[model samples]
Target: MKNEDQAAMLLLGVGGGGCRLAASVRAVYGAGLHAVGVDTDALANRNAAAGGMTCLLLGGSRLSGHGTGGDAIQGRLAAQDDMQNLQAQMNGVRTAVVMACLGGGTGGGSTPEIVKALGEMGIATVCFVTMPFGFEGQARRKEAERVLPMIEESADSLVVVPLDDLLKDAGEDLMLENAVNIAEGIIAAGITLLWRLLSKPGFISLDAEKLHTMVMRGGNALFGCGSAAGDDRAIKSVAALRGCSLLRSGEALKRANALMLGILAGSDLRLAEVGEVMCEVNKSCKPGCHVEMGTVFDPAYEGRIELVALAFESWTAAVMAVPKSETEVAAEPPVADVIPARVGGRKVRSKGGSKLSFGATGRGKFKGVEPTLYNNQDLDVPTFIRRGIRLER
Candidate 1:
């Protein structure tokens, strides 16, 4: 990859709420990294540009009728579509940092598809998912659970950031915008570290396939830290740990000959969680490797855990490297039904798979739910051709 494409950022807006989150990051850091956003919504492109980043709108709806059978098929199609769209957006970038909010419509439904496509091309894809608070109740929970596995399965590494957790000590200043801002800060810091490490002397190019394999096997760990409670001492402790871990990580990268990294949140976490995160990261980065650190706390503005970071190594690479057999595919339950569901007022068929709803009882029946467009319509020939031609999947 050339210098222009070496450090790139791929932002995928999966759900209704994801755009705000993606926009938040783009708003803060303009131009240091190449930003590309994808959404099923037609407004996605506008939203991305408004946020000060470049983007592509896949133009679709979020609902696909419980994501099974036909929904799954559509999901695959959407994934293919996204890859094709993204291929043109890609400028031969070496490392791609993917950010998307989890749960909700497009981000949740389509993220896995994008990952699979990029992984096939040997590109390292790291996902940043903003999980809803349990307070949002069941609807969000099911969304998180459903998408979690897909994100894990498709990406090189995934860092899950719980929105509710970040708000624990947010004080009066905490709001959706501020929360996203915080998350973006943490994410930016994490990605910057990874980029710096990769650009350092003695670092060689890492194959995307190897990187993706390492992340899929749970070879990654998450850590959260923020000073929502105003505890600077505790915050510093976490920062110290992260710093040490980064140093060791760089060392490990040199020895293992690891190539790429995926960063989730730039900010949006507490300070106290850093050390524990680094410790866990070191453990996962190198199975038997150990890193030492200490912790501290403060009463005012208590530091807490908020963000998650991922580290990869040879063992993880090996786990991800081994290909799954056909039996492996058949053994697991289908994520959703394959048949399309009939949307009322139009010709639609139900997709088959397990149906899980998170919110409100009596709102709709889980079984035989109508299929909503990923953006609310069937794939047009031009769009379909675009995805097929680009992804080549």
Candidate 2:
């Protein structure tokens, strides 16, 4: 990749697990990768820094270099306190890939806040978060679930990786530590494929601009990869991808609105193999689903083929709004004719000129207090009443 392209992108790691994941990706990606890690634990921050990532300590004064100790509230507060420091690292970045593991304090609590802040800065964010394993207990799982919506609200594209599903594909007989490492390795390798697709020389390139556009319109995404060698390597790799739990056994592809497929193989890759891979993938997806494919050739991948895919479930078209002509505007239909109103548990046709308004309703107990205004709307009033929605009897 060009220096300008590298400068425009950032790989951000949040909390300890996130930092480790980022470090792993960096190791695979080699040099010229812009990376940073943030955590409430000073020791963890130092460790990430030791791995060549720029580290920032969150809640330094309040937490006193100690971690949140599983308290998500503290993690949230720490992020709030050091948010300015984090922003300082985002000097020239236009896109960020965030890595965080939910169910813990720093990852769960701070991720939403960080993503929100990045959005406000006009930076597009793609967040990859792992849900805790079931054995981790209900509390952690609940915490992760609660934090998910918050992160989704701010992230341009959200990819949720459930550790349980990830580990299930690995094997049942592995040790705990080894299983965790392998899971991380798998995720890191997938991310590395994406980076390589952008950075490495390719027969067909997937540029950063294409990624930015797709991500901005792609809401929720699914990422998975598979590799195979020897005869029919391309077809076999795609078959393995079909069985990947991360993609819900190829169900994600069937339901996807858009797909970004990357193929990495050696110079010996055949044109027929590429055609076959595309043919099989096209058959799996719905008609007219937006698809982008790129291929990279590397000598190291001789006799092997690896496929990485990102499926976007909620992809929207980038249609530009065209101003209506004066004649067309004059012939516009009435709002009542276009939008049906729901009344008495059913849709009802209303007269075109009928106006619906809700006057100020008296507050129950705090009637005399100043109204709580949000965006110039009174928050003190009932939401439905404020919006002039007629409730069913």
Candidate 3:
């Protein structure tokens, strides 16, 4: 590997699903890219080599790489034990990307912990994760929801793709394996374009620091990757991007306050084509939005154009810069009443994992129901209501 390869962005895949994605990304980008796949299952680690990326087998003593048997705690412990080795892979990389599919044990259990570990390194981390399909069962879906907030808290920002949404438009004759393979290819292509924008600079030159500000300073985001070849490829590529299911067919883009676009084109890319793409982007966003643009000229895409666009919520540029009107100005967001932590109850820690230790807790209006643990908080009936945290519309 060249010095460029060693110091370029790092892509880390966690668990079986993530390893497959890492492999897919490696196959497309080839040299000048470092990819690593970590898993508790030795078999998953082995099978992940379809594209020949580095693989790490974790939890040799406890799981012996036999697999976590769909247990998240085991998956988490496996990654925890091998954390030093995993962190070593991130050294010197400009940025780190994590890929994982939630719902199963290893992906769900270890993803948040892995994000937390990357956070400790003070590197800008972005995660692209998948939620379980509606048909995948309540247990998996619940598990995905359980750790989602934690993962968001750990990573700078993340893009979540629900499996059901991804699979909704599959053709009737498409086999499940083929559908998964197709999705992985698309994902790999997107990852390739993103790193190209950072490591391989073009005329506009968006560096690691600028890319960091675009991603890390925003809320959760929507990402889409698409490509087109032949006449008017730039316009066609942006159209393809707006049509991807992962981006909710661009409905999310319309609501976003912060947007970043990375374009990869052949040496023949024209200025007019660039202008057309920018026009489409400006038309899509409302006034007061922040847009970042970067382009890379690659001989590999000589006759084609590829685009990777990310749309995210921004408090500074969008929310604060709302349009003004003399007659009726926008009012500030409503503040809801605060919920009390101590509602006439004696707080006591539970001895084991099977006990509720709140004594004589008076849950104001919820009437009858036991307190449940959410985000590491214990509370009575209607936890959100009792906690006084109203959900914003």
Best by lDDT: 2
| Candidate 3, run of 10 with poorest lDDT | 342-351
Worst 10 residues of 2 by lDDT: 342-351
Q: Is candidate 1 or candidate 2 better by lDDT?
A: 2
**TM-score-better candidate, 2 vs 3:** 2
Ranking by lDDT: 2, 3, 1
TM-score list, all predictions: 0.52, 0.80, 0.75
Best by TM-score: 2
Stretches of model 2 off by over 4 angstroms after superposition: 198-201, 205-208, 298-300, 319-393
Tens-digit per-residue lDDT, 285-366, candidate 3:
7776677788877688899988888887532342222234545543332223112332211111211233333234544332
TM-score of 1: 0.52
Clashing residue pair totals per candidate (backbone < 3 A): 67, 0, 0
Q: lDDT (CA) for every model shown?
A: 0.46, 0.78, 0.71
- Per-residue lDDT tens digits for candidate 1, residues 183-293, read 566655444444333333112234443333333323333434322234543344334334433324234333332323322222333443454455444543444432222
Give lDDT: candidate 1, residue 345: 11
Give residue 36's error in model 3 in angstroms: 1.7
Per-residue error at 354 for model 3, in Å? Answer: 28
